[model samples]
Target: MKKKGIFVISLDLELIWGVFDKVDYKEKSSYFKNTREVIPEILDLFSEYNIECTWATVGMLFNSTWEEWKSNFPENFPEYQNEGLSAYAYGESIMSPETEFYCFAKEIIEKINATPSQEIGTHTYSHYYCLEPGQDLQSFEVDLKKSIEMARAMNIELKSLVFPRNQFNSEYLKVCKKLGIENVRSNPTDWFWQDTQKDSLKDKIFRTGDAYLGPINKSYSISSLKAEKDKPLAQKASRLLRPYSNNKILNKLKIDRIKSEMTYAARNEEIYHLWWHPHNFGSNPQENLKDLQVLLEHYKRCHKEFGFQSLNMDGVNKQFQNILRN
Candidate 1:
């Protein structure tokens, strides 16, 4: 008997909530507009290829109106050291009907909830940043409560999570476990890939180079998945299906590197997890979707050749539990 390789894709589904701090929403309005437009296409492609996925959606996206969003705001909201990082302030100060493209996505969330082989996971109530300064377990619990409440309003019971900004801490994980999240998408097992607070120039350079070259390992063993003895299943992400860029040579190398790693995981029956934000597809969506098609095609060939299986984050946890039981 052969152990089966598992493939999982988790999308950080945030509209304006994810990137409001990074760019001017007015200037990049078209980028977000394009993001909203292409989501159905992305889902259609996933369905066509029979891919199962997890959507770690921001809790704010569950709101149908500004009033509902206000009503559900967590009482113990984050007070980031940088006051500007607060999504609450951003929501109050800048939000308007015209800006709804970035602020709201209840329709998209409903579509994902109804889709087969898809799980709705939480990305916190306000795209909460855990590793950032002035954040703690108490505030996080309130955020989690609001997140759960918002999902409950939509008739969704979220169990899987991917921290906003990939921030993770032991106390944070404890909070997640307490709040009913059974599994989470953790960063790669690499030592250099620590939480956001420790990020530096050297780390950024290595991550960029690793995208093109094949030095660092991304595939993980079945035993590695069992490291969390009694905690939320830490399903480590293997690679990011990076968005397309202008440099043709660099882009080709990146995609090739991903395919090579995927092949290794399939051959060895390890896990390969790929992730990215939906807004990444916003700019130059045509090329981004095209690159996605190439990966899906490769996945098809891998399934035929090596018996690789597709799973969402929830499915990954369930699969690992069954593996441990046997």
Candidate 2:
């Protein structure tokens, strides 16, 4: 029997928490509300099909924020500090501890955990940019340790990590290994200075869905000068042209690319790591989720027709480790 391509869906899992820290509550709520409505639908589809996925959650989201909110506002908040909804509801107050955003995140994590086929992993404590020269490696290690510790507090055994901004620092890998992380997702493409280490490794690096499946042969023109506050006429025209040029065509190209990559992986019996942020679906989540559903359905059909088995990070690592030992 021919080996099937390994299908791995890695969700960044830090949607609102990551973005909310930067953007105001109003805009964040709007974005998260859209995301919340879309994700559960996708999760339902994945569950129905028995598709396995890995959610690398931000550690702070799991415990600290709730605790901090509760500690700060005890009387108003009745639930546990960390308790929040899995999906943010529409028109939620940004200041309230009872905001639907936290609740939604919690619910999703619980669902992911309850789903037998799904796997949960850690992204980091702060999802901090350790690649910047200013950030010391020791601090990065401590932050990662804290992330794992947070997961442990929740009784989640952290196994895998996805570097923030796809900015991977080699020293960070050592921290991951020390923390008992089995695998770390590294970029497969060449980067100038940020993830330059990725270029050196041939097969050790794991590629994600966006890298392999995002739009191809799409030309985008942007204003050379940073427009002040107003949207320039030329910029608006370019923006209008971008969708017609790249949206559907790029999506199709990405799907085709993923199909080809899967086929190649199947032939070689190599691991094909397909990852993407759950929030990538934020803009047009339904469409992106549908794209994901189509890919997963293809994977399921291939698994049944061939001998392919879907493996999470742990399974992938064990297989690779077994191969290494032999």
TM-score of each: 0.96, 0.71
Judged by lDDT against the true structure, how good is candidate 2?
Answer: 0.56
The per-model lDDT (C-alpha) reads: 0.85, 0.56
Candidate 1 lDDT by residue in tens digits, 35-135: 99988889998999999999999999888777777887777788789887799899888767776667889999999888889899999889998888897
TM-score (C-alpha) between model 1 and the true structure: 0.96
Error of 2 at 155 (Å): 1.3
Residue-level lDDT of model 2, residues 26-51, one tens digit each, is: 55565677766776776788787777
lDDT of prediction 1: 0.85
